[model samples]
Target chain A: MKPEYDLLVVGGGPGGALAARTAAEQGLSVCLVEKRPAIGVPVRCAEGVGRDLLTEFMDPDPAWISAEVERAVLVAPDGYRITLEPSMAGCEVGYVLDRKRFDRDLVMQAANAGADIQVKTRAVAPIVKNGAVAGALLEQQGSVSEVLARVVVAADGVESKFARWAGLETAVPLSEIETCVQFLMTGIEIDPGATVFYLGNEVAPEGYVWIFPKGDRTANVGIGISGKKCRSGSRPIDYLNRFIKSSFPEGRVLEWVMGGVPVCRPLERTVADGLIVVGDAARVSDPITGGGIYNAMFTGRLAGKIAAEAIGRGDVSADGLMPYDAGWRSSKLGMALERNYRVKEYFITLSDEKLNRLVHSVSQIDLAQFSVLGIITELVRQDPSLLLELRAIRKLL
Target chain B: MLLIRRDICGYCGCCVSVCPQGALELIDAYLSVGEDCTGCGICARACPLGALEVADEA
Candidate 1:
């Protein structure tokens, strides 16, 4: 990497890759850094993205597309299954990706776009000049160096550090974080075209377990337990183990992955003087589902575009960078994040009985949309008494 | 005191985001604790792998 660039992006996930690509494409000198030695190893995601959203970034490549999902099932606590059509499956059913290849493809695109991509290079601290983040103190192969830039984009994933070092409180609270674990196992009987979600506190308190099919008999079986609910002997892995034992008794383990996701509202501020934060780093992941790839890409691209515009105008202060923050907050993705956070807060308080009833009610409806609001609307239609609780979220839809 | 069982740690950085003090850092995929850690045990509870533990003051 050169001693400096117009834009410096930290992290190699979809967010950073997109940020680097967008900024570089806009004629800015860009450098993207990933602390991991390679891209997309130790896959942290459940490898699921909506078909519509996936198509927006790149056409599905067979090498990275594990499954072309057509249907989804929601298994209630009492074992009542509700089958959802692909259109009504929300964001969970679309494409179960092989993220190991998918993530690399994105970074390759950024590299092709003229951004200098560095692997295993970390930004140990932010470089501030004149009280603004000008660049980062980067560490590469055990040696540290100063790399200056006009703007620094913190696209780091859930464990975002550069933004914190630059003076933003990005810490996710215990109640707002999901401690997750996933196992890729084969020999399990699963419909390759369908993904499944099992909901119940007993199985995963304040969270859910999922089966994202990778193939006919192989899938990413994962559980996300609320961090606040995780206790000794009942951690996320323990719950996932119980699920594997019951659902895929003879499945052979292929891989194990563990991580955390922020299921909270977007950060109070995602931009600072000469800085912008994107994706999970900005707490832009869906609060209910904890999905973030699309959000990350969306914000990453926006940050790039706005950064270029701000620099063109000869201003890179927080005020000049406010457009990146404002642009996303009003977009469709931002609305969903806000709506999902509220719905998540409400749903987490529901007993399994309420969820079962709601799931049963929605299963019978020909819902126009498959979002949380759609389910809530149908439930309120069946029982008018829920209008009070539904009214708050009703306004958003 | 706070203790980390590196043997079982997957180094996914789950414990870092929830630290109120911002006392934990995940660099090079390695979980590191800073001097500000008060043994609050929040990271221990947030760890999905149960790799962190906190001992009460004597």
Candidate 2:
């Protein structure tokens, strides 16, 4: 029997939804399968994203934005602070999203574009025939059914098994993964127009604590620590609770969320014969920030468009899908992720004293604007020895 | 019944997502197997850390 769908997208997050919508727009028969009863619930992200990154794919929808940030407040271990006007010099602070609405709208777009969306449906395993993925065995409501497709797009977030099942090495090293946990709290005093980042090993070990305001008196406070650096046996939640008690003792408890973040380069291999992996499954999140939504949607749209084109040409093999990999790497999103990973590697090696000094120096510099290059220049000026470090790091890369 | 390997559990909560019965909860960063568990073994299969295993009930 012929395949039931031209594209079967597993996991209906930003990536899968966009992939399904894009494929359907291209006139391909698309099916989007999500394990949850709804697309976005039990929200797991910190939800801070730059406006430019978001506008690249879709317009600014008011239904999804929770708060507008004007600046980024960076705090050091010893309480030193450096505040940067994010929107100036193109380093925009952007907005924290209401992910439930944001995610649901994206999936709705896919559905409106003519993709069949199945919720509470889990893809148990990929169906392989003649050494290539043909579809998946789906389990929904205690019943199992095999859904056939010409191509499969895996966007199953951090614990994706589709890529692994398709013979790709998606295993992220402990050093490259971030164990993140967050709490949405009320009764907190926040700038409402600024996001706070607390640094220093004492605060969160190799990770950092963030306060992204949702409103005048509410925020999503969280921490993300490197898995390898979590040696104290204290969970991220414990660290967060400690930080909260000290910072916002009167804050009311609300909700708790936990998830793993892949803080590495995009997967070395995201495409296999008749299979394509996008978003978190492909490890497209930023190594330093652990932000994946924008990149997920970008890569998803690219994958869907490429899948449609490849299907039209009747070549669904690995060679045919190589363009998706090449396209992602060549995009601005891909370039930024690679650069950030290197920056993160270098930053993690600095001592707390050095970090405090670096921030202090930048705070003193009367720069009229803020940009990544501007910050790097300030760091280099504060310590000329970093030039040698940068050169060595470049050679290693 | 479900068993969790405490030493290996990073408590990332992937198993909680795949549980059809909502039988798993991460309390204080540990998997707390609840009464709703039907020994479906789905959590064990979905755990990224390989920290969960299922056994026959006595």
Report DockQ per prediction, comma-separated.
Answer: 0.83, 0.12
lDDT of 1 by residue, A158-225 (tens): 88888898899988999899999999999989988888899998989999999989988999999998
Q: What are the iRMS values of all candidates?
A: 0.8, 8.8
Evaluate model 1: give its TM-score: 0.97
Residues B1-58 of candidate 2 have per-residue lDDT tens digits of: 7888998776666565455565565532456777979987655544434567887878
Residue-by-residue lDDT tens digits, candidate 2, A1-397: 1238999999898999999999999999999998777789768799999988898788988889999888898898889887777535655759899999999999999999999999888887799989889899888889889998999999988767677767887666666667777889999988899999998887876778999999879999999877666533465666888899999999996877678777878888788989999998899998888889998999999999999999999998989999999999988888888888888888788779877876787665546635554566677777888888767445433
Weakest 10 consecutive residues of candidate 1 chain A by summed lDDT: A84-93
How well is each residue in B1-58 modelled by candidate 1, as lDDT tens digits? 8888998888888888889888898876578889999999988998888999998868
Cα DockQ of the candidate 2 complex: 0.12
Note the residue pairs that clash in candidate 1.
none
TM-score, each model? 0.97, 0.87
- Between which residue pairs do clashes occur in model 2? A86-A91
